[model samples]
Target chain A: MRIAVIQFPGTNCEHETLVAVRDAGMDGEIFRWNRPEQELSEFDGYIVPGGFSYQDRLRAGVIASKEPVMATLKEEAAEGKPVIGICNGFQILVESGMLPGSGEIDLALAQNVMVKGGRIVRRGYYCGWTTLRHESLPRRSCGSFLLDGGALLQMPIAHAEGNLVTAKEGLIQELADEDQVIFRYCNSSGTAVDEFPVNVNGSTENIAGICNPEGNVLGMMPHPERAIFSWQLPPPGRRPPGPGPGRMVFESMRRFIEVSR
Target chain B: MRINLRIWLKIPDAEAATVKNTLVRRMGFEGVIDDVRRERLYSIEADVGNPWRLVKHIVRELVNENKEECLVSIDELDLDDGYVPVKVGLHIEDGEAISAKNRLVRRLGLSAVKRVERSNIWKLYIRSDEREAVAEEIARKLLINPNKDSYEILRARARAVGMRQ
Candidate 1:
């Protein structure tokens, strides 16, 4: 399957994401934002990789969201093509109103506010390893299609605006009821805690990732491509040499595309 | 009393240029908007005797004398005409503003500083007759994300009645 790793001006992770896609047995290429919009239709799946697009001029992802390429990406997504947005890519999707799939701005990934013990501990840019528990069932979402519910995967999240917040009432509850809440920040043992370091970015209800109602579009704050191999894993690596937990996300996208066809 | 510090870059503001470009070229505000300029507004609520002396210290702490220009006013914001000044600030907890308040009080020993509110003033020079309506549309569309931010249209008011420096 041909996958497009979309790149904006400041998108730094496109290369690694393309690497992860190829390693997952999918043919992939870095798709620039300035590219012809119709050319994007040739790709089977799309991945909006992370970076500070437009140098986060107006805000992270907002400027990039208004681009014409994103409009075409939305069309591709409507065709049930798997569209995975990682980190700033997630912000773009949310800003573009693609994550909720409502074709309207429904939520925002606000500034990171790290809270612990009912007090603000830290705020702003943070980069560190974090664990994500796949909250959706197997095949429920394209990005986590192969991951079973409650499956814990370790990944690194580096961002300043990963805090998911919604002013819309009952939206979080609605997402939960629809099984659209895909990944949640969790402890090593897979408990979705609501505290700093565990909850990570103080996202609503510890939510790290979410999918649209159709499950084709998934937006997540963590960087899965950063953990595609055992060698990329954090220190104290005693396990057998193999693909890392993050490989499943890409692999699952491939599988989802194949199954859809 | 409130100390309002309106700070703008002495150099060309790339952020404002980008916003103007995005709004005009991308979001289809080409004809409606003539230009977009931005200024950082810091409203510090302080109870201090010899307010002028205290403001000097506050300016020294907050305003970078190089590559930035500041206009100090007290009580009211007297913005220039020919543009609609839209004030955008985080409706949710603003950590930066909180930090600024703490810095002035705890670190700088400006104990009179009771609060500090920070906001971006987007000065939109609009060509449309319905300036306020267009400004609001632009604010909702491109400026503020309603989830965390809110915007206010700062209409022209009487000049600063308290003090101006």
Candidate 2:
């Protein structure tokens, strides 16, 4: 399957993301944002990788969301094609009103607030490894298609505005009922927590990732590409040589495309 | 009493330029939007006697005299008439503003400072007759995300009864 790793200006993770895609047995290339929008249709799937797009001016992803390329990407996504947005990419999707798939702005990845013991401990940019528990059914979402429900995957998340919040009432419950709530920040034992470090970015209900109702569009905060290989994990020398937990995300995408076609 | 510190970059503001570029080239505001300028506004509520003297110290602590310039207004916000000023701020808990308040009170020992509220003033030089409407549209479409942020359009107002610097 051919996957397009979209590389917006200031996108620093496209190379690694592309590598993970190829390593997952899918052919992929970095697709620049300035490229012809129509040319994007040739790819079987799309991945909007993370970085400070448009220097995150005016807000994290609002500037990039207004681009014509995003319009085309939205169109591509409506056709039931898989589009996985990671970190800044997730912010872009939320800003572009593509995450909820409602074609209207419904959520915001506000500034990070690290709360512990009911007190604000820290805020702003943070980078560290986190455990994500798959909350959706197997094959429920494209990015987590191959991951079983309750499966925990370890990945690193580096961001300033990853806190998912919504003003729309009952929206979070609706997502949960629809199984659109895909991945949630959890402890090593796979229990979703609501505190700093365990909950990571103070996202609503510890949500780390979500997908649209169609299950094709997915937006996640953690960087799976950064954890594709075991060597990339922390406490370096002690870990065994093998594929990392993050490999499943990419592999699942490939499997989803194959089965969908 | 409130001390409003209006800070603007003496150097080129890349954020304003990017906003202008997006409004004109991307969001179809080409002829309607002539220019876009931005300023950081920090409204400090203090209960100190001879507040004017204390403002000098607050300004010293907050404003960087080299790359930035500050305009201090006591109890009111006044702006030039040419553009529509839209003030955007986080409706949720503002961590930075809270940190600033703590720094002024606990760190700098400015006990008179009761609270600090921070926001960005987006001055939109609109060429349309419906400047306010267009400004609101720009604020909704690009400036503020309703989930975490809220915005207000600052129209022309009577000058502050207090002193201006």
* Docking quality (DockQ) for each candidate: 0.83, 0.90
DockQ (model 2, Cα)? 0.90
TM-score of each: 0.97, 0.98
Best by DockQ: 2
Question: What DockQ number belongs to candidate 1?
Answer: 0.83
Model 2 C-alpha lDDT per residue in residues B16-55, reported as the tens digit of each score:
9999999999999999999999999999999977788888
RMSD of each: 1.5, 1.3
TM-score of 1: 0.97
Error of 2 at A197 (Å): 1.4
